[model samples]
Target: MSHEARQARLRPTLISFDVFGTLISVRDSSYGAFERILAETGAHRVDVEAFWEHWEHRNIVHYCKPYRTYREICELSLEETFVHFGLTGDGRLINHYFDAFPRFFLYDDVVRTLDRLSRRYRLAVVSNIDDDLLALTPLQREFDLVCTAQRAKGYKPDGALFRYLIEHAGCAKEEILHVGQSQFTDLVGGKPLGLTIAWINRRQLALDDSVPRPDFIFADIQSLNDLVEL
Candidate 1:
């Protein structure tokens, strides 16, 4: 279907969001954390970009296992990345990364976009994060409901978290729109479950045709206002 047709069909009562890369800016924060740790260990020459990609892949892999605290998952993933590069994984460095969550800012458009959308649609967050870690972010109070992997005991690409949102929202799957930046988790996970998926391609990345396509695509949260009229 074309974007206009999808837009016409979308009359969501609840807008579910993936917090990390959607509302909050994870890329910069992750890079900063990795850079600091690398400098501390005299591994500054290592490719931080590649390190982040590996760490993220490992984190997603860990999410598939029995649920662990997001902190534990982060520590484990960081350790895996360190071992991959033959660097000693320092406990303090792991703690630094864990503590850095509160410092990560939202994208400039997030608050305004959310505020506007909230006037029309109830907002909820479904994240592959622990409750405590999610509480540290500025987005903790922005949603009508917040579901985490820690609470669901499962992560995205599994549909457990999205199911939780559906149940809690007291709405049909068609009445909710799940929006996020991760194609593998959010799009692939939510689309199969009959929820309308919105790919928030903030970075303008090309869509991977192998995965399920989102019903709607927006460059950022702000673009949502154009598709969803109050």
Candidate 2:
């Protein structure tokens, strides 16, 4: 469907967001923090870029397993990273990421756009984080609903988290528009559940043909105000 037609059809009462890369800036900061940790720990031989990818891959692998808190998953991934690099690093080093994550800055447009959208629709957060961590962020705006992987016992890209969202959203699946940056998680998971998916293409990356396409695509959250007019 055309963008105009899709916009006209979408009358979502609840707008759900992906917290990390969508509303907040985490990727670059988290990588920088990881690099700092490597430097501080004296593991100068470990390549930050390679270690970042390996850690992320481990995290994603863990997501498919039964269930574990995000903190445990992070530590496990870090442990695996150490094993991969043949470095006897401290597992507690994962605490650095935990400490740094909650303080990560939000996207410049996030608060302004969320504030504007709040006047019309109920705003919700659906993230792959623990509640305690999420609460530490600047996003303590009394969102109408907050669903975390810790509460749901499942992470995104898996249908379990989105299923939890649909069950508690107090509305039809079609009435919730899930806006997120990750094509793998939000788009792949939410599309199968009947929720309208909006892709926030902040990086302007090309969509892979293997994944399901999003219902709407925007450069950033600020564009959502235009799509969901009052």
Candidate 3:
């Protein structure tokens, strides 16, 4: 049975979002920047598609470390990834990834939806990214509250990040609806914090049974716009 049906019922007063893949498409921008850096060497070649796969896994791995801002991790990732591929070790070329940080792809109806939703519900962002990286997104203007791992000193799934937001937002946990894509980050992290989560399952990937459960599910952020009107 679906959570919406099983629960007593919920009418969220505030909506929190996950920025990266949900509100913005950083995958292409991140990959393209890496591609340019790779191209500068001119002596190295790599499968661009494979680059994203390996890069994403490495990124997820970086989160397991003690704690570092996403930008720092990405900077290190750029250096290590290129070195591992036997590409040029030029930091300047790799630093371009950070230089072109603002080149992110915003999702459809984001501004429009936020514009509508903000009227009724508070809006916030609960992302796994660091302080600087999360601020780079165009959606910053649209958020009422912004919580980053740097401020929390821990990434998502650690629950510390969500707890930071709960305290910062000054809203009851029940009233806060955390809308995100990853159950690992959103559900597992926020669940313990007592923040209701709306799982934005955009990839059509099947949910792993072991993941912490979510309060609600949406196909994507596009579908969440209605929450404001409702």
Candidate 4:
């Protein structure tokens, strides 16, 4: 551990993580799944990159409107993407993606970081995902508490899930550190609740002024352990 990690070892009682982008490489996994499905269907003309972007946009729109399983949002957004592209999608394609979701790989550093962090602090997950889908990920066993949008009936940026974490985990707002890759969902959303936020900028994206800045910014979870001793 570094000097900062040594110095900050005992403050937080709980550490919460945003699941999809922070721990798993959702973008890569989604793109690969889509690419394979399109290739199989001979939908070679579809612009895979553009299609995925539109799907993501639609997914976010649906996520904010009402409570739905993450799989349902994915299927709905995919159909919207198909309509936008003038392609009639088969239901099988949606199922294919859903099945592949659980298989999404974790970031190389996640397992080791979680192993170390779990030893020091109570670990929890605050995710935009549904309980079923989240259970499919390898991280299911690592966390002491797993709070999801499904259980909260709303997504991140809505605050329900965070409230659930606080109540269920029996931790005070200041005693928890929220770590995630999304500036909109995790950092901006959790900060106002009086929870310390750590922005895991795995992509090294430039900061936007409109979002609330995080208390700490790390290139990845491994670096986080360097600053806070897991």
lDDT of each: 0.83, 0.86, 0.72, 0.80
Task: Kindly give the stretch of ten consecutive residues in candidate 1 with the minimal lDDT sum.
Answer: 89-98
Note the residue pairs that clash in candidate 1: none
Query: lDDT per residue, candidate 1, 104-220, as tens digits?
Result: 989999888888888888989999988878888777465788889888888887777777777788788888888899998898778888888889999889999888988888888
Segments in model 4 whose C-alpha atoms lie over 4 Å from true places: 1-10, 40-42
Highest-TM-score candidate: 1
Q: Could you tell me the lDDT of residue 185 within candidate 1?
A: 89
lDDT of 3 at 129: 76
Model 4 residue 74 CA deviation in Å = 1.2
In candidate 4, position 128 carries an lDDT of 85
Considering TM-score, where higher is better, how would the candidates rank from best to worst? 1, 2, 4, 3
Scored against the true structure, residue 79 in model 1 reaches a CA lDDT of 84
Candidate 2: which stretches are off by over 4 Å? 1-9
Error of 3 at 164 (Å): 0.6
Arranged by lDDT, best first = 2, 1, 4, 3
**lDDT minimum window of 10 residues, candidate 4:** 1-10
Structural similarity to truth (TM-score) of each candidate: 0.92, 0.91, 0.82, 0.88
Provide the clash count, candidate 2: 0
Clashing pairs in 4: none
